[model samples]
Target: MILHGIGLVLLAVVTGTLSVLLAMALIRWWDAGRGTRGMQLPQGLDSSLKPMVLLYRDQRLVDATAPARALLDRLSVPEDEWARLLQWIGPRFPEAMEGLARIDRSGRFECLGQSGTGSATLRLLVEQVDSGLLRITITDPQAEYAGIVVDSMSQQAMEEELDLLRRSLDQTPMLVWRQDAEERVTWANAAYLRKAEGQTDEPIGWPLPRLLDSPRPVPGAGTRTRRASLNQNGAVFWYDCHSHPVGDQVMMFALPADAAVRAERSLREFVQTLTKTFADLPIGLAIFDRQRHLQLFNPALIDLTNLPTGFLTARPTLFDLLDKLRELRMVPEPKDFRSWRQQMSNLESSAATGHHVEEWSLPGGQTYRVTGRPHPDGAVAFLFEDITSEMSLTRKFRAELTLGHAILDNLGEAVAVFAPGGQVVMSNRAFRDLWPGADSLGHALACWQNQPETGPGVDALGARLTQPDADLRDSGLMASPQGQLLGWSVARLTGGRQMVRFRLPDPAQQGGSQPLLAASAG
Candidate 1:
């Protein structure tokens, strides 16, 4: 009876000790539930250091840190309750369920999610916990795969957009290429291949230098644009390239610029031809650009304007050029020095409309015919011709005419000159006094003819004057108003003109004058 009682006492002591240990275990579990820091999770949880959310095994949201809640809000997921959050995440990322399966099987996994519009992306790392809950940690984007996560539901739309972009790049007339950091071509569009001219089989994955006859190194980062030429099937082509760096790759956009190069070459050739032509021409040629600076000048321009070629090539303005000409007495002097600039402005305005022409008569008896013509691109060209010889000839001709008038004025006999057209060209004053209204300088021969008089004198004079091969002389007397005789003679002159003279006899010598007239006619 004593041994049994001892065993009962020991049992009671052991039962009390067991109850106390069980109570302590329950308290520790409750502390852990309240987020005790010292308690370690199965996945080595960093809950306090990073943003994290805990999910129950049934895919229900349980607890989240403040940062995790903010992150969930940013992802546009519901944070109000577990059921609502699950519903939203499941529909948006159907793969999350698949990721959950992976986590259940593998104990740890990752999930990627994209917003509807594709702007925001969320990466969630899920780990199985000792408490049978899913520990989801939001990791940085730079971890494994560097990209944004977008919903695959709109993947078709995104693919369509990418295809459109590709088509646009392909159909473009320009050349496009994607290259690596070593300037090795990884891809080229149709335009770029066409420019290759079938010289190479395929240029993909080849050094960019091998694509050209004499390839140069790719431009450095500082110079992202450049121009180069290529020889394709014995023909030359030019290109302009622009580069954009994308991480380790470079996007190269090139344009076929053969046309521009050819045009520039043609322009240079044409200019050279023009320069040679102008070099031989006597007329002075000067071209000024829109800024009125002298761009081109021929040798004649220097000679005519008396300006040095060095000065002209220094690029003088129109006003400065004209002032230089004035200083050298090559151009006419301006009456008002202050208004000369305004005149130059007017000159340019007029020249632009069409052409402005004027004769500049200098004080040194020199004349210049200056023509200002407008050219394309708002340029102006001036042509200058020296007309000193023409002016001198004109002055000499006028002087001879005046001398002839003076010589004819002093003659006493009544004389008249008739042109080949039977027009009375000139007559002495005595002829006007003798014949009242006949051959008075401007009258035609018809004005003086007296109704085709049938006298021998008239007949003979008409044949000599009208017939080209007739005799050169005709002289006779015609009856005057008072039955007196007036002697007249017609003779051919040098220039197909007829000279006619009339003689009036004195009364005492009237009988002898008739005999003299008959003798002269014979």
Candidate 2:
């Protein structure tokens, strides 16, 4: 019994010790798994994948893996732009998050951050060494790359604008051109090269000095400038070509002085027509502007002034011309010119309402009756009428009256007097001699003279007056009492009077003077 009891005690002690050891081991295992009894669990686990941190200058955002947040932080967006940037890039790069997740899954993530403000480069670098420890790296692109993109866009816009400007210039009516910095012609519009006066060549991009030089046909004295060239073809004219520096090149534009000139041949023909039609218009016709500067002169004015066409340029002002006239003894004096201009001004002012006339003296030994009137615009027209012919005609008519009455009484020609109503008042001695049988005063001579076909003398006279542009003067020829054949001429006068004269035909053959082609049918 004592031996069994001792074995039991030993077994109990063994069981208790084993139990304590086993319990200690179980506690150690539990402490190892859930931490020690007094120890605490870690706040985070050491894993291959970890959330990434995005950082700007002072801004930071914790997002998915490094690549995902890296792209956002690469934009270098401000804190305020966080939500906006995510919204913008999310739809734009839908696979961007997936890429970042894969980097996390692969245990290799790149860190992204803004290196400098407004930079396009994304700084990327590996922040972790372990493959599964959420490796992080930084990604960065050079700053010049952003500048290149901006410059490219600006160049594109500039090219488009330049092209539009060129097209606009080409479509414009006025001549337009462009030159490079080297003064070389870069572009010219179509109108700039077209022949304004039917010339066969284009005139654009010509050298600065060459364009201004006078053509070979140009008169040296007529050229107004040495810097600019002058070329004229009919109505085409060019002048005042001047160059000015623009950037590195020069630009120039000019107009021909003869641009307003049409062919003078039409004007010359008109002058000739006027001279033929109004042969008695003794006074010259001229046109002057509001400033009393002569613009045009008729043939008579040209003759009277004896001035060349260059008078417009040489004598720019009327006063200057008046001074020249006085020097040449063509005008009286400067004072007279002043008075004439004053009167002309008054006439011009009045001519707006009606025509005006005045009498003025010339430097020569004559006076002119000047009439002035307004044109449609600011121009004034002048007409001069010389009364010298009318005065002479009046004097001659008075002297011829006495001779005319005597000739009418004794001539043995049929004569008749009529009032404005065509009533015959009396017959002449010639009528009494020829019709001694009947026919008294107040008889209408139409009874015999109108029917001159009954007379042989009247019948033969009709054939001679058949020429065009000639007046019918006689019916025929008849022998007088002295056995001399008389041919009659008739003509109408200014008033209601007709005159008839008789003379021998072929008087030269008869050793006598030729009879005058008398003025008849007065």
Candidate 3:
């Protein structure tokens, strides 16, 4: 009986100790749920009942209600929650940051947000719960009580989209930034920060440095684009900057333009070189574009055509330039103005397909050989060359040749000139009649040797004519197959040539076998 009673007492003591420990645990938990650093809420407000409330310890997020956590999770930034939250809120409520800065001294502050279409007015309440803890409360009194509910699939898709946008902005080579009305840089992408810092490994701070210097302020409406340059570590980098206004601020983008700038400079230098070359040319050059407008003209063109520099500089059309030339009497005169225009049109059409040349005889007795050639891209180039001296020399040569031929025809004796190669160089009319078809020296010799009435002297005549250096003159008398006495002689002329002559003996010396005196006289 005594042992059973001892067991019942021990059981009662154990049960009482268990009940006391359970009560202490409940009290500690209740106190922890109230707030941090012994903070107490107002009589009618409960933290669990509030939809949007965030608790921060210094720069780190300690806890947040369901709706507040959802909002912070939607922000796509590499920064901590506090920084991301501030960035989103500072742009909309500019004074909010200022209020938070003074929160320590004032203990608490409230900011009223502007209401928009289908949205309630926001109320932001920031309080310093303790030295190291801060509480931010966001509320909308006119909003209905609705739960922040999102399906798993929808949440995943939104997260993926946000990640893509964030990655794109960070990885793009272009520099991008946002600025407020006061010209303070509020946000910048990774590329912008890297260039602004210039090879520094230091962490980027808020309010990024401005790299582009604009002469004028960014316009408020429509996009404004301009060329800008940045100097980094003594190296100059060029960019084409574009700015667009977003509400009261501006968004700027800078695209690399170094290659474009270099290409444009090279083209300008090439054009200048060509212009200098054309300026020094002797031939008058005029180049017309596909539209037939005069695009380029050389100084020689002005001197040759006698057109004023001011007139040519005006870039006249093809017809207009031709009309000006007509007025100056630089081109050949046509019967009428209409025919002249049609002729010029034909000249342009012909030049487009191939080379076209026309000779212009001016009133001043100057002749110009005008040549038109096709250029690349449907352009045409005209070259004017003065040919008056050339034409005069050609006419003089033709006249001399005519007079010489006339003198040769009047000769009474038949004459043939042979080149060093024994081919006939020239034959006069008398020679052609005497030796009806002897076109060469060999043929003429054959005709003479075949004659039955010819003497043995014919072979000696042939040998002398064939010798290029046989300077000694030879003469002989022979009878033609037609029963006429003929005299023939061979003489060497200048330039290694032989001149052979055949003539009928004079009536006074016809009967003598003594080689006719007529041959000796020749």
TM-score, every prediction: 0.54, 0.31, 0.52
Model 1: per-residue lDDT, tens digit, 377-478?
999999999888988999999999988887876775678888887767888777776666764333423433453232455555556667746655577665
The sequence of per-residue lDDT tens digits that candidate 3 reaches over residues 1-522 is: 899999999999999999999999998988788757458555444433455789999869999887688778878695689888897577546679889989889999898765222344567888999997899887764542543333222333456567788899999998888888877889988898889778456765667767887433445447878999988778888999888888888888999899999999999999999999999988899999999999999999998999999988999988888889999999898999889889999988998889999999998999999899999999999999888998899889999988887888898888889888878889888888878778887888898888755665666677788765556448776665554677778777899887888885567754554442332332
Whole-model alpha-carbon lDDT for candidate 3: 0.79
Provide the lDDT at 75 for model 3: 83
lDDT of each: 0.70, 0.49, 0.79
Off by over 4 Å in 3: 1-148, 199-205, 214-221, 375-378, 396-522
Instruction: Summarize candidate 2's per-residue lDDT along 194-253 as a digit string, tens digits.
Output: 533234455433542222332221233332322233354654354544344455544544
Error of 3 at 386 (Å): 2.0
Off by over 4 Å in 2: 1-163, 169-245, 251-369, 375-386, 398-522
Candidate no. 1 TM-score: 0.54
Instruction: State, as a TM-score between 0 and 1, how close model 2 is to the true structure.
Output: 0.31
Weakest 10 consecutive residues of candidate 2 by summed lDDT: 513-522
